[model samples]
Target: MRTTNFDFSPLFRSSIGFDRMLNALEAASRAETMDDWPPYNIAKTSDDDYRITMAVAGFSQDELDLTQNQNMLIVSGQKANAEDGEYLHHGIGGQAFQRRFELADHVKIMGASLVNGLLTIDLKRELPEEMKPHRIAISTDSALPESETKRIDTANQAA
Candidate 1:
């Protein structure tokens, strides 16, 4: 197995508070090299909405499990025991498997459903009002000395 070397020194020096984010990125990179069973797709349906679709062909809703802990989402499936009947050919994959996904801050699972051998999970990012950017009003008026040009001078000229 090939090893990866990443230098986060620059990020640490420049940023103030992003240790969790950097750690998550490193973990994700490591996980990318793992198995790819039960093919999945992550799609951004909208700006704050996302969908994760996984092909769980031989697994039913009762055989699957979904849970969320902090910023991690885990999905696993296990096939039930089979009867004494022998199969001439077993093409479909019914082996047990587990998959995990790291979610960003403020991202939460909306719902999940299994239909037609496909499992779809919906996610939404809801940022708090304090975290959203706000427009700052700029003071364009320049400060001038009161004695230099007083309002009395303008009033006298008008009179």
Candidate 2:
């Protein structure tokens, strides 16, 4: 048997609160599917719009739940055997599945729908004003006189 270890020490840095970041990262890493149970696709719709499409052939809208917790978007489903059928070939995947997606801050879920065995989830990115980049004005009179600068330096040296 062979074993491997995950190194998380590199995430810690000055004042960024690495623990919080590490927690989120750990959750994301753990959510990766070992088996492609229910395959999904995420696509950009427009400049600020996005979409997520998942293949949920046998599950209904009532069997699925969508939630946004913290910075994570979770989609979960459970099938309740709506009909009894004797199958010659059971190729369709009908088992319940839960899918998770980590979303950046201010990302919003627009809507979700199931059509032709495909589950489509729409999302939009809404950036906050404070987080957006803005230009700052520099004042011409903000510069100090040379004599004032020298006096401040002399005081610092004296101290």
Instruction: Report lDDT per candidate.
Output: 0.89, 0.80
- Cα deviation of 100 in candidate 2 (Å)? 1.3
Q: Tens-digit lDDT track for model 2 on 49-98? A: 99999989888889889999987899888888676767888798878787
- Candidate 2 local lDDT, residue 32: 42
TM-scores, in order shown?
A: 0.77, 0.72
Name the regions of candidate 1 deviating beyond 4 angstroms: 1-3, 136-159
Q: After superposition, how far is residue 77 of candidate 1 from its true place, in Å?
A: 0.5
- The whole-model C-alpha lDDT of candidate 1 against the native structure comes to 0.89
